[model samples]
Target: MSGQPTKFLVPLLLPISWLFAGLVAIRRALYQHGFYKQETLPVPVIVVGNVMVGGVGKTPITMALVNHLKAQGLRVGVLSRGYGRKTSSTLAVSPSSQSQNVGDEPLLIARSCQVPVFVGNSRVDAGRALLSLYPDVQVLVCDDGLQHWPLARDLELCVFDERGVGNGHLLPAGPLREAWPRKALRHATSGQEVPCLVLRTAGIAGPHEFAVQRHLADFAVQANGAKRSLSSWWDTPVQALAGIAKPEKFFAMLREQGLNVTHSQALPDHADLQNLHIDTAQGDVLCTEKDAVKLWAHHPQAWAVPLQTTLPTELLAAIDFHLAAAQHAKLSSPHGHQTA
Candidate 1:
């Protein structure tokens, strides 16, 4: 989702984007008018998603959230749509789960967070299944479901990288999935502004948004639990690969660390790498943690560089406040966990 088209191209694609925006408006209206039902889970849900269609470092943020909540003694479970998985059935993720079964991101989160995770086509269903299986789970964190109206969320965190609302137009014309301020404004008009907190994953923070610091860990971990400094591979031939929305960013980071990435491959986001081949002779294969989850199954020699993130204390406090407030409201209601 990088290298977006020039602004001049916006005119040519505006009609289509307008159509898409209209459809989005209509769909949201349906949910608002009660024509379509929204389901609320038994536990509080915090959604980490983006306004534009691209990776904005949501998984790492989710992993950070998992760590923060666990420190508070909250049993948090994750739910995802399992985008690009082969199966459509809802299922719980495990350490042994393959990317083809539960998608790479979910599998990575499950392994990294060591918490229950469920994935399916429907986020609501996945959340329910996770709660049923892990009854003690106090909260649910949805990896990417801000626009998933069917699954009501108590809190939403919108993530943005350096490209904040890129060009600020709708899909095809620009990078946005819907009009940025307009859509959010519409929600405010409906008397519920979606209780969202804006986060900048990269670059300068926008107004009223918090900045999150992210950096690659100094060491990369092997599938067998072995670890080595990134500098150890500096002199070796290395094949760098990333299947994320912005693969170049990962490559650039590796280069910044003085690792010579002789060969770099950028596959589609969430791509199944069963057909791709990386020659070790090119050097050691270095990849993002999300890619490593899938790549390790086929290529055990590949090393995963995890992203270390620091979230602002104010943001964490806000999230905790919202979760507590939602829980308080839930306790006051006679009927447990009704739709919003």
Candidate 2:
């Protein structure tokens, strides 16, 4: 529990890591034995998650996928554990969905895509309720449930930002929530087979993977939806703040857009703005649209840069193939009734 690192810690860590890995093995075995049942929904579930913890660009990718699905005429709904939510039950995400309830990411998805979203500790239950509410939804995107074992997925898209599995170690030592090697193997199990997409939203290139980019809106918008030109803030040194996994990126992008930011604050992902006391008189406040969900209540003058993200065409092609295959599977199955 101390901040100091000892030279002996490395040797001790291997044995300790081995012991932890053994526990993970045992947990996997218990699930395999039916002691823990991995639940599957009637709809196809695409899990957009990362093996590495934090800042892997999952939210942008999730929103991009949801937009693509909706564009392809697929009725898509989203399920998320709603990581920082106050409630444990399944709650529908509407304009009214609070970051305190539905979680920040789900609220982001709901806001950007205008699609049905539900959040709960159990992704399976959230998926069930979402489907029951919107039965026509053909696909379900679990926002960050790659390791959430209860709900099964047909596609497991492991998103990484520029940082690819930092230090290649597990939590406490490195950034991963689980061991990296288990990713491929776990995707092969659960009766509901899964496929992997090594996706990067920006600076990506080539085949099985694709490159994409994120953009901020030309005009920053207030919580009331009033648009303010980026040029308006050119006169003052602004504070670019963020509470997302990739806050650095938001700050970087702001600088790239030629803004003179006086300071930058990187809060934990989905930070409640109620706790932030900005020096409004010192300078203007700037933030990402994700933070806008809560910042509105606390700081009216805070300007949020709405992100415009694009998924690579090649990645979209693969997803299209899966969606088509899923449709065919549905029509050919005994219990399946409809096709789209």
Candidate 3:
């Protein structure tokens, strides 16, 4: 949904946004010095992040970038902070890794991207291990890390899902992780207040941006990677479950694709559906591709829709320029440092 200076709430939230901005500024300054510790990765790191909260389709973009690098014949590895994981140590994400262990996003990445994927509280540590294990790996892509300055980054790609800096606030009051204007003012690179790379689903990033709509596939992929047409389920009213951000979007997409959805189940961001059993025996059950990574372990018959995002040619061009620049900078400097 697009944000606007509504008739009611926008003015009221201004003070709180200012305070949040102040807090962000303070935390960043601490990191700049030694007050807060930040880590440096041994290899070049590419971070894809967002200023606004929620799914701006980061996973798809990450997967796209990873594949693009792989197509270019460059060895690539993925690193994430493992936001909702159970373990605290830096470890590689296993195909058998549970969402509770390696976190949902990383698990999804590992599944689609065959290259090594790791998650830890430290992206730097993850990147280091990934590099050590696969020395040929030239690029490290970090998921959801713009504020995480601890691990330095060579290239930063910012994603916005139609929510371009919501309310332009920091934290609680709005969706932004930091103040928008302050970022433009300060030439902060790693995290402070920065303009990494603005992404519209299918548009150029440098000037203004445009949205690229994400549409669900007409079918769901099975546990064995088999496909089932959504139209096949259109005759019966069934359960449509989603555990990712914006579950309603999933439901809407299902309806748009002609699924006769009746029960729409929305769970927490990384919900463990292994425990919940639905009466799907009565009808067809559906879920999102990200959720299927976890859900299909229990219900192999679960149908999950894959979402594909189209990035504009212009942004792809911009990315190529930045990647080249980063590689050049790295090759040019004998001693280098970067964060995720």
Candidate 4:
């Protein structure tokens, strides 16, 4: 099973999907009605997530946002649930941290951006942990926690790939983690629209959504920090390995780059590679950046392709505008000054 809900089977699964959606609605109601606690962190929180189940280029966007903010001299930290990690304890991610212990994505973010990143089951816990350790951090970015209502966010950016809402049904039927327009509309009912931005990671952007350009980096980085042009492997047959939500997308991107992928291995998202066999000697092994963290330990020769993105200037402006608004609102609040 691809773990994807089949389109043809959506009608059959609609009943179950409705049941799941009802449960989700109830959960949201619980949070909204004050039955559950939603924590507003001292620092402004920006959430980047997707309504669909699979990856929608959130990680790259997060990195881009972090870099953008860092260029402005703003201290930024990242928080994640650290999916697929072995440890349950909340810990600050560092270059020395193991991917299996803190998750591949968080480890990559920490190393690539050289910023504070904390991983745990709860975004609130991760945010607190990051701030407790790094008091100078000015902003917090929560990765893939759109459904986590317990953590109040100043801004939410929901990303979508070319798939666009795929059949427009909820889990076990379609690709959606929640209903599309209905979920977005739920926020509008509160007046003055939702504090969310819809973005298209690939393909044409919708009338109201922002479009981001994502592509493979021209060069691949080796474990020794050596650079190799992706074109170098164009003539030779290589094995493309991706352990991501959409491995085929990576394979397609490699093809687009003119790489001759004779073999492609689509592993489960965040598969435990500690014991996985990788015979790089068979041929050139190419992988996504997320897989490089663990694969490098075992196969240093593997080529890890990094993704480069061009974010819309308007999006950046909006983000800055909102951050300023949030800061001012926080400062003028009667809740007392809370820093760090």
Candidate 5:
């Protein structure tokens, strides 16, 4: 009985998965043949996403990359589809913007990175809108848009967690949103091949992949912007709540930090905690920063532990090379105009 479901579902889903692959191939062909158009922006776009489904720490990686670019004295902007947001209209994300309106991840990015972020269903539209408002922005970092073929990107960072391309199968059977080891993409306007780099966000990096180290910050933040050191919770019972894909990972990390987590609640990814009731008597409520964006509104007492990520210097160098090449190409083009 235990293995019966797997035997039944795998056979049932395999054919549909094959059909999905066919559709994906057809769509790629359309874009490759110019039947479908990919829009290009003036500034270079770096898309950070994953072929595998579910959250694989893409937001943390995106924030880290944005900060790195800013440190290099380049004015950077971010574009996102604003997944799970209430509104579909294009809008800029501000520190004051509600997660319900701008999406939790984008709101967190705007607050954390302190960079311009715009959300829209269309990445190209959001990119243009961001540029229109922040004309001096030198580059755009897309939060998650690897499969969004309509927007041309100069560089791609495919992020993966411990589950690297699970089962190596497509949806309905496996975790992949698209086929892995895909062919290179081309710049929509310039028709030049775009560069892609694989980043293993957790665990050991596979062959030809960069490694990203992620850990929780020593302190947790309150709704009012107050910081509490993790050491302060040593004596108190902790009730950890994570509304993320891999909540167990968060819980394990808390334990690793010597936290006494008495009660751990794993909510669905992007869950609306507005109506949900949390028992404070269990202990001190702790959550991920992504969850805190929305969770803080109703539960002001919840402490948000931010995930700190470190990227390889080699990865940054590779990105810098691509950015320089993109800049040269933009400058040499007769249609290019100065924005920075």
Candidate 6:
């Protein structure tokens, strides 16, 4: 259903959406009232997620944040729920980890960032596991856990794409998973409200949100880590396919790069590509880096285009400011001092 409810369906779904909102509110209240426990790790956690369901470029942003943190000389680790994986147990993600076991996104992060990553059904558990093994990691980045109230975060980065809060309704009625300008959440340990930052991954920047510049990398990568300039395919026809929340966006980006996309396939988000068959006779195959992690096993020749993202310096400075404060507070705490 494209995650956006049609005008005709909105009216029919409004009642159910209201019920869903009530449930979400109740869940939040439970956590806030201490009825449900929230776990906090020793290292600060920065959650990159979106209020709307579906991908809004959170993975790329998460990777970018990890790289930025690493450049600042801080040891960084990643935690994820490992969505779409077959296993429910917590497992450390390695570059060699199969997408079916550790999830495509987590594996991609592990390989792309070359940092420690762990995944489980519960992000809290995943964070604990990651820290247990990588005790030196100074910070943790939760890939997609805006609504995961169980694991408290020191900073929240709410991401948005071109479709910002479409239809402005929740659940079946629209794309919103939570209300816009959501209320602040409390820290797991200190019980203080955690701060949030708004980031627009695409489209025009809102007055209060930071805008990120996103474009396909000039080069495409192969399974063996070989790279080829995208311009090499300018005159050659290629079959482009994407299994993402908004496949059209990827296809459109390819066209913008002047690639001759003769055939375009938009599969379901995180669609299994083990049996995907493309007629090479049509042209060379092109896919996104996320799909490449799985597609390489079946279509090793597929050239995966990586999406490069640039965040504003102001955003990084803001994050640094928050991290410093969070670290200071943690150090001053008796329990944190004892743990340290």
Q: Which residue runs does candidate 5 get wrong by more than 4 Å?
A: 1-8
Candidate 4 global lDDT: 0.84
- TM-score of model 2 vs. true structure: 0.89
Name the candidate, 2 or 3, with the larger lDDT value. Answer: 2
Q: Pick the candidate with the highest TM-score.
A: 6
TM-score of 5: 0.96
How many angstroms is residue 37 displaced in model 6 relative to the true structure, after the best TM-score fit? Answer: 0.8
Count of backbone collisions within predicted model 2? 0
Candidate 3 TM-score to native: 0.86
Cα lDDT of candidate 5 equals 0.88
Clashing pairs in 2: none
Q: How far does residue 46 in candidate 4 sit from its true spot (Å)?
A: 0.3
What is the per-residue lDDT of model 4 for residues 1-340, given as tens digits with 9 covering 90 to 100?
A: 2335656787889899899999988987787666887787877789999888867789989999999999989999999999899899988899879998999999999989999999989889889888888888889998889998888788888998888887777888777777777544222112223378888998789898999998899889989999999888877889989998889989999999998888889998888777878766558899999999988988888889998988899999999998887777667766533664
- Which structure is stronger by lDDT: 3 or 6? 6
lDDT of each: 0.86, 0.76, 0.74, 0.84, 0.88, 0.90
Deviating ranges (above 4 Å) for candidate 4: 1-4, 182-194, 335-340
Q: Estimate each model's TM-score.
A: 0.93, 0.89, 0.86, 0.92, 0.96, 0.96
Off by over 4 Å in 3: 1-17, 30-39, 182-195, 201-207, 335-340
Query: Which scores higher on lDDT, 1 or 2?
Result: 1
User: Candidate 6 — which pairs collide?
Assistant: none
Q: Which lDDT tens digits does candidate 2 get at residues 182-261?
A: 63434223354467887766554436555667788778988778888887776668888999876887888888877888
- Across 33-104, the per-residue lDDT of candidate 1 in tens digits comes to 678877767777889998877788898999999999999988889999988899999999998998899999
Residue 289 displacement in candidate 3 (angstroms): 1.3
